[model samples]
Target: MLPADGSGPTLAIRAVAAADLAALLDSLPPAAATFARASGFEAAAGSHLVVPEASGGIGSVLFGLGKGSDAASPFLIGKLSTLLPAGDYRFESGVADETLAALAWALGAYRFRRYKRGGEGGDGPVARLKLGPTVDRARLESQIAAITGVRDLVNTPANDLGPAELAAAAAEMAGSAGASFRVLAGDDLAAGFPLIQAVGQGSDRAPRLIDLVWGDPDHPKVTLVGKGVCFDTGGLDIKPDTNMLLMKKDMGGAANVLGLARMIVDARLPVRLRVLIPAVENAISGRAFRPSDVFPSRKGLTVEIGNTDAEGRLVLADALALADEEAPDLIVDMATLTGAARVALGPDVPPFYTDDDGFAAELAAASAAVHDPLWRLPLWMPYAPMLESKIADTNNIGSGGFAGSIIAALFLKKFVERARTWVHLDIYAWNPSPKPGRPDGGEAQGIRALFAAIEKRYAGA
Candidate 1:
């Protein structure tokens, strides 16, 4: 469904019988013990197993969904490709949560086929899973499309997904919603948004601010700013080779922002939605902005580049400043800004920065309920000094290596004073390994959490 890689097990599925198994053959019926044995495998409720002929061997597999675990176990079905024998298969029992099941099956079917185009992931033969009756075909298609869009965006190389391409992608989304969209690029970027221009100046591709607006002007304003360093070569301050490998996902914040936007617009949320992306390429070149360079931001705050690698906050500062100018009811910025964030909280859990206690609590609760998962790290005003700059208003990098994530949040906090409520998320957005509904690569981390929170907040209104 979601991670549709066209790979999965092909098997005949049915409820197991007591006589079907090796040991419980005489003692029990097929349905009772089969579920308990593979309980660890997580079968959905209403799922069943296949009992092959006594002589031909147990040729088919079983499926029984356990309790609904939200969307957490979608990837569990991926194991079907590995576990099933090399043969074509079909489904017997239909599941109520068919969308999730299809998504799980697709995710379980994925293999990164980049290096060896024709190579098999393992010695395991290709298995295909056929659909059963209890599925919503229309809804299944839509969810699959949304999830696959995220995967494709994440899978593309940085070179192919640079600033220009990122803008084009955003424009495409805007068009889908019939929203108004425009971009300030090149010299225009400097004329209106100085900070955006400064960070993007170092790269060959002109940096730009992408703005997309939709819904009634009278509606509550909700603004989203995403850091889109399509490719972060660490600018003048380059990262080591190992660090650069996954840098392709540096734009993960942008990707996830768009993913969240897609969900909002698709659901026809009543708020006035504005999506802002400061797209740039952090590359080492003669034109790249260097450390210690003081640049003027859209809000007219002068920022000194303490480290070229700290460019994400710079671009976000300019965009967030613009979002603040609107004084939106809610402003949120997502970024893969700091390795320190990952180190402090680890990749699985993202830390949110916000001064609003109620908003923070809601986000935490929503994240947990949806199984999207997030953690709240303090804004910690005491660490604000780490961003002090002798020449400019502030420095992008922290003076101390410790508390780096908190410092980065504080730096962004300086530019966002207008919104009634604001939240900043520093997310890994990538799953290092496979989880149930989540795959190993690019993930839509806090989107669902934010979606749930927003939905709950506005449900009565």
Candidate 2:
């Protein structure tokens, strides 16, 4: 959190690395050094020590930066937003990336209080950061708002955030950005997006194809498709209680894309942006599409339902097909589609698939620069046979469990033929535990890295 104006008496926060702690203490005033020495302050990452003034009031805070080869990330400073007392504070030194540190401070201050009575949560007033002139205040605020929007949407219970509600949220965002928004539901949705309809037919709420277009038509076209499985019960193949606990975050992909779209629109990137979300709920009922049932997709490809739990890709397939029809300069789709990705890279790093090496390089560079972890996974053609179907053109899931993430990527690749470049992101949109700048609930995984790459590619075009 940041203050509107730096007019208050702010406490100075000095970041000291573990190896530099003794030197820093020696340089400090005698009383302060003695206090720190007595306190046994070792400068471990995320650890802090508070010093008192001679008048018995607050003086300055000593924050840790860890040691070499284990130095804390710039985001580690985020911990200070909640750790420090409710007062204005300013970083005195030791932050390498000021902008990112400021952004982290804002992100760390977020709390999901929608369900809390009277919106009462947290222990006390949040610590406010006095951002320096080097930090881009507007940009940092926009990033915070966008990311928190994703967390809010994903944290919402499925009972309150069905396909219809998700569409409404997208419509609201579009209206605010002066973009054209439309939702195809009922007969229109069934006719246009058969895969989307099939996935949602079991739910009473019905499905929707949410479309939003913004920016100048003459600009290079960039389309984003997100899997909006509002709630995934794994259909007839019901998931066990343990796996079902976090199903509310099934639409995290949709939430993330909307967040990324907000960033692009706010920054006014020079590109025609189109967002497609096939909002659905994969529930179990007599009408649920059965395993082994064959269905025709929007792209004219027939798919066999190999497994009901693989419904995220079913909805995304239709949306990606629709996005590819225009043969946009680029097509990027994000989905919380597979656990295999998490098994491979864990929750902190999501795997992305793209054929364009140049664009992949740019994404990798941007990812490292922004600290948004993304790893490139091959769309291995060798795994194509695993998705073979006996009756349909292909199966919704692979014949074997190996390379599941890659198989999912290959499956979506089939629907995108016209786009000059296409990228698929398999994201675990929920953080399992609280960390610096990232809380335990829903997260916007790859949007920042994707935005950086997009901005670089199209900002000057």
RMSD for each model, in Å, please?
Answer: 5.5, 1.2
lDDT string for model 2 (163-270, tens) is 999999999999999999999999998888899999999999899999999999999999999989999999999999899999999899999999999999999999
- Backbone N/Cα/C clashes per model: 30, 0
Candidate 1 structure quality by residue, lDDT tens digits, 1-461? 23233456445554322233334323334544454465543345434444455465655566543453422344444455545655666544433344455656665565545546566454445655556556655544544455556666776788789999999999999999999999989678888788778778878888889999998898889998888888888888888889988888888888888888887777677889999999988888888888889988888888888898888998999899999998999998999989998888889889998999999999999887655679999999988888889999888888968898899899999999889999999998788977654668877678878977876775542
lDDT of 1 at 198: 77
Cα lDDT over the full model 2: 0.91
lDDT of 1: 0.75
lDDT of each: 0.75, 0.91
lDDT of 2 at 242: 92
Residue pairs that clash (backbone atoms under 3 angstroms), model 2: none
